[model samples]
Target: MATPILAQPDVDSGLRPVPVTNRNGVLEILRMRRDPFSFADEKRLRFGEVSGMNALGIRMVTCSGPEAANEILMNKDRAFANAPAWSYFIGPFFNRGVMLLDFDEHRHHRHILQQAFTPKVLKGYMDEMQPMIAERMTRFPTGKVLMLSEFKQLTLDVALEVFLGLELPKPEADRLNKAFIETVRAGVAFVRKPVPGGRWWKGVRSRKILEDFFYEHIPAKRAEQTPDLFSVLCHAESDDGDRFTDEDVVNHMIFVLMAAHDTSTITMSQMAYHMAKHPEWQQRAREESLALGEHLTYDDLASMEAIDLIMKESLRMCPPVPAQPRMAIKDTQVQGFFIPKGTMVVVPQMANHRRRDIFSHPDMFDPERFSADRAEDKAHRMAWMPFGGGVHKCIGLYFGQMEIKTIMHHLLRGYEWSVPADYVMPMDYSALPVPKDKLPVTMRRR
Candidate 1:
């Protein structure tokens, strides 16, 4: 037997009830974690567009397909809130970050935060990080290496120096990186309590580490002007002269660091795997990078169209933060399916990116599809939303893109690598998509 997700609906609204599975969604949580795309597709086929399930003791409406995604993300009616839903998973760890705010408050904070990401600010960041990136790239070993871990370390290095304006010793950097990893992994941990040595406990303890670091440094950042993110956030203000308090700066700093580092790592790892598998594309992108000279300038970042295409295609295939979560704040309807207030909603961008009706050869790794001649992603407005959509779309998109392009630019100029043609890198869908076997590559200097 199935229960209506809406339980009951207003007759005049003329909306149908969302179909929810009778089985416990909490039980399906593990199965879905194993492969969320397959699970999403299965439910969509069986129950139609708006499928409902209870996961981790919360009832959620999965807004699969383009229409549902459009309605939810566009949020025309302002019926959704990001805080309650995200907080359910990452609340304590990332509390009150920009993504966690709503409506007026969200808009205000975004306005102030926008100051840190302007064209001039981004140029400063690009200039600052290029040398940091180049210095790290110069140290790559000349044999088989775990590309994912390597990228993770590089991105962490970039974030700590470029974001915090601090160059800590190896141990401190490693400690900060470990704290970030624990806090992120804790969000999805099955055990929520602070049991001894448990994920939640580790995350709670790590949160203190992060808070202490940022809180300790906020005073110095506020006292001076620097090009790093910490200084920018400390000084950035809206037209109304409103700026972030020390607490606000610390919260935003922690959240932004995770977002920037994790997403860049995932994107780089996916691109590396793709490049290793398809050396022809690698060769092509390499040529483009070589043409631009050894060190990339702010303007040269856009010239590497080959790298840009590959990045877009890689992001499409293995989107970081694949599913965007929100909760209905008021009675809302998505594509004629009624959603009761308080029901959690998920926009499955990774699954949506592969829709047959939208993307041709959705599973194929063809970068040309994004080229001007093809423009397959243009089929629908929400067709290629790896960064999400509407007002809550990622704020750091420009900075993140520049960082990836800069790193890839350096990588192509200095080295080349490959993986066996027969190999298929397995992905762990449990958390953010990471290669189960840290992708191994045979590398040598160009």
Candidate 2:
């Protein structure tokens, strides 16, 4: 037989290849799981914008900085896919979810989903969330407590009531929470199989639980015109008169629930942590909230500029979804590096947000960087993409921001919280980036 020609590596073409010291990429994966931002920064410094890694037995490229990020996320050439790559991490659990769909299908589903997130729909969601947020804030424990744990429960409750329109009994709610947690945990499992009692196994099992829950409710949701997201999704129609099938509603519900609650929990945790760390900013936000009165209208929520700044800084520091993953559906070159077809690509959101060439003090927590005077995020169109970019950008962006801001507004009005001066909450990257210790803080009435 004739010799098979091997593709030339980027290093051979004068582009820096990602320095993979480990043969199997296991060590790098572990380091990345431990501290993704640090790992990305180290690689960027050593390898520049485009670098290659042998991860999960695949040649994966990490794209950092605005230019490379825009190239991959924009995907103008239709050379990349979201589903196949994300499937490697989360596809089994979140199958056929909007984020996992690609090309025309992704656009179609997104258009349908957009009906559930229009301005009128979001205003209703905010209305539902405000009272729930206030009621939940009243129940928070005083003194030293794990705010991350509390925020997780709070956001999940908001998601349950506002998104599902279900006042499920405590036992059922707890069971559902466990299922969601397991499903999320499975996405990052190295095992990636349904071995009994394994992370992936649990995830697979949990996915069934979630599917059953949504599937059971689909008939009712389709029959009624409730204001909850689940109901809206069931009845929502695209401008072209397209609607989701039963399976589509369930799949999308599971994915949206996971995305909405888990990510909001992370954002709230970061805001709470940073507010506790910097009392001045907290006070500024609190004063802004006070000006809006105890009951918030949609207009009131919009007027909290200080809270917006702090939230922006919090998102920049710790984006809920740290990295956006993609797969090169066709061979493509990005930033002078050749990416072979079927190669995995990552738009490192966390690393990109902290690029010093883009931000003045990349490591420091400074909300003022977003001020009109500074406007550092304007340095590049993609410089501060916590919600991601391109055609597959988060569909629930406005809903999420409203949720975060509303929750923070209530927290500020009702309580004062603090952490020890030197405390640093280590983040767990098993699924989403969350406080490993659950982010404890001392809380009391304001």
Off by over 4 Å in 1: 1-6
Candidate 2, 1-446: lDDT as tens digits: 32211145555576433333333477788988888878887877776677676766677778788888899899999999999899999888999999999998998999899988989988999889898888888887898899888888888899999999999888998899899999988888878779999999999999999998898888888898999999998988888788899999999999999999888889989999998889999999998888888888777767889989988999999899988889988767788677778888889888888888888888899999999999999998899999999998899988998998888888899999999999987888867888889998999997
- How many clashing residue pairs appear in each of the predictions shown? 0, 1
Measured by TM-score, how close is model 2 to the native structure? 0.95
Q: What tens-digit string does per-residue lDDT give for candidate 1 at 1-446? A: 54556457888889888888877667777878788778878887888777888777777888887778888888989999888989988888888989999889999999999888999999999989998898889998779899889999999999988899998999999999999999998898888889989888988999999999999998899999999999999999888788899999999999999999999999999999999999999999999988888878889977789999999999999899989999999888888888888899999898888888888888899999999999988888888998989899999999999999999888988999998889999998877889999898999998
For model 2, state the Cα shift of residue 124 in Å: 1.1
Pairs that collide, model 2? 18-52
Q: Each candidate's TM vs. the true structure?
A: 0.98, 0.95
Best model per TM-score? 1
